[model samples]
Target: MERGTRSVVRDRDVCRRHGVVGVLVEPRSQARCAVVVLGGAEGGLHEADAVALAQEGFAALALAYFGSPGVPSSLVDIPLEYVFRALDLLSARGYASGSIGLLGGSRGGELALLVGSHDERVGSVVSVVGSGVVTAGIDYAAGRLDRILATSGAAWTVAGRRLPHLPYVVPPELVRSIERDEPVSLRDAFAALPTGDELEAISIPVERVRGGVLMVSAGDDGSWDCVGLSEVAAGRLRAADHPYPWAHVVLEGVGHTIAGPPGGPVAPYGPGPGVTFRYGGDPVLTADARAETWRRTVGFLRYTLPRETADEA
Candidate 1:
């Protein structure tokens, strides 16, 4: 790891070099917890976020399942086993077993929940603007929501196969066009997308998750209906009477740009320079939500993963 100042040491695609994939961030000193960070369909390594977590005294890995070298060019056909491989690498490098946590944004958020539910070793899960059930990756054409949804392929892969996924379907009236400035009804879109067998096959069983869970959602998400989706995630956990500690945070004015740790720009226009429309929150509100959610995320992980490993405890 190459030392950056005194707080973090960055290993650039150290995983790829070692026949694994993604980047790993480590604290200069010993860390109490380990975290895996994931980004959305836009697909870059969550290196900044992982480094931020490392700065908070946790070992962190920014895992990229797609859109990076040695990984899939898109979210299509990604093996679920990649996540397990990341955990195995962290364990081999001295992060404690079963003390690992997952933090994901957007599509990553959906995955964090799925992985946490499937693996007992995951100590906690933090999702930002995530989906409750499996969702298909829609290739946005200059077409209507319903038209594109019917044609978009599966977003995730498992055991070398694709799992069923919810499509992005909205009635024509509710969604005018993707390129224009028009209001879309996320609720309507989600309601249309959740196919019976598809949702059943891919929905994460929150009751089975082996650790604490935290979900952060924005009420007016432009990218997807994260507010609706987050509520669905929490609702499932509650319906299951989940034994593990869990909570949900709804930011009233914010939208899809709520990724990143505390101390970054508020980003009213979503992420990047080309963000033409409002994601959801105004600058002040989005900024505040970003800081607050990140703080809460760290606290939740600390509560679940202590200085001593779970096995030792």
Candidate 2:
């Protein structure tokens, strides 16, 4: 495929969830054929990843679960059935010749594993900063402090005690929601949802999955247990003795959000807490880390997704 004159298209269409309209991007070149799906956090798609995948010669689609018309950002409100239905839309649309690869980060990563496990049509799967196991509750208080220090380099204090270094965010509200049966606040509602463990319990075996998998973990990420999450998922796959191909990586320095150049166009979703500012956090691929991530992603798709020529082989 010619690298120049890249073709890209962005449009909205109704997803399998009846009234939900999602955004889809189709990359140019007939040589490489793979449909890359972007998973959103609360509900909307991460636009940066979508653009990056498309630029690398893969058709990318981003599904909006919430913040789209009548959709709600609360994860607990969205039904599991609807999420699968959106995946079915990809296969039904003949994206990737009826078999496409899945890629998601954070919460979307957990969802990708679940949907890919349940569906046979997925050709490959990649999860960035995703966990396969769940913690009893999310710790957001440290996250709040980490955010303050990451950007401003300020010291943090809790209960009148000054801390030497930035702590992870484990907000009490988050814990309260996790333990509460009926979420009284929106924050509680989000926290009350199932962790990765719940998703894993319902997930199918990776060995049984038709597509390969590429799992990436941000070791420096303080929001979740990145190392443990990747290990658990990878361990399960290794134990299954499955035929599917899978690779796992734990990047040492970077966090969950990936930028292009040093601060040039960081991953979309706004300036998150505890996010190290590189190149001013462009929300695009501005940092070297995000650029490397894009390169790796493109390479992975070329190798794992269906190929037409032996050159990629």
Candidate 3:
């Protein structure tokens, strides 16, 4: 797509040189900044969102951590070093280290927070329906319903060591419902995870993030308590007196799966193979929320990671 006089370009092999699976989108004109876009539990490239961002003049990479060729098939023990390689790819493309941002949704949102907290180079973060703490990994290929539970295994590792994470204690009733292909909300399972001091070990250190943070969540999220989780990170930032801007917005009527470019299909709720996933929201309200959220996200990124002038580029 063309943005003004500049045509946007998509490069599928740029990240491959850095040992990462991703698609890079950028305007033919020098990009203003760099952004890494991540997908949630669905696990694949978010190329559409990256392309949208590129149309807005930023270099955007839709990165795939798992469930893709050349990567782990599931979300188990993925190394943070791989993410670092994505950053390296952007850096090699001439984007300043301080101008790079991270954007993600759902489990991808959790990953964004974790990566931003650990990497000082991240200039900004936008998490939609994400968690503030590390959660156990999901094994999609596991036959038993319980094997796919959040408590099954670690999702990420740093320096080859597993990161401490919150393990969901799934109730037997919920397991039975899931097995029966009944509609089930996992919010209770997430809510039942430990709190207070118990969370200190697994909670993402949002205060350590080098730049602004924008977290958006659905109040009626059926998958997890994202509003509460975003608040936890916001609280950390406030307590630390973080210099950069940070805001958490709760879209009152929506459910999980709220992040994406606006004006797409708005199926607020859906049923998976083994269970009916309850993504709660009125279609009209969800559509409005999606537009507002995307606007704010773009504004937040523009403010935090400003575009470069032609001379600077």
> lDDT of each model, Cα atoms only?
0.75, 0.53, 0.84
TM-score of each: 0.86, 0.65, 0.93
RMSD of each: 3.3, 11.4, 2.5
Over 27-80, each residue of candidate 2 has an lDDT whose tens digit, in order, gives 655434545454534356655566566777676666665545655533333444
What would the per-residue lDDT of candidate 3 be over residues 163-253, giving only the tens digit for each residue?
A: 9987767788888888777777767565455678887888889899899999999988888888888788888888999999999899998
Best by TM-score: 3
Which should have the higher TM-score, number 1 or number 2?
1
By lDDT, the candidates rank as 3, 1, 2
The residue-by-residue lDDT of candidate 1 on 1-313, one tens digit each, is 5776558998875687556568788888877679999888678687888888888899899998887787776666566788888888877776665689999998899989888877787888999989877887644442445555556677767777787776655566654534454544334555444546655666767667778899989876776778776777787889888887899888887756777786765554533212243465677777778888888888888887757854556
Clashes of each: 0, 33, 0
Q: Worst lDDT window (10 residues) for model 1?
A: 269-278
TM-score of model 3 relative to the true fold?
Answer: 0.93
Q: Candidate 2: TM-score?
A: 0.65
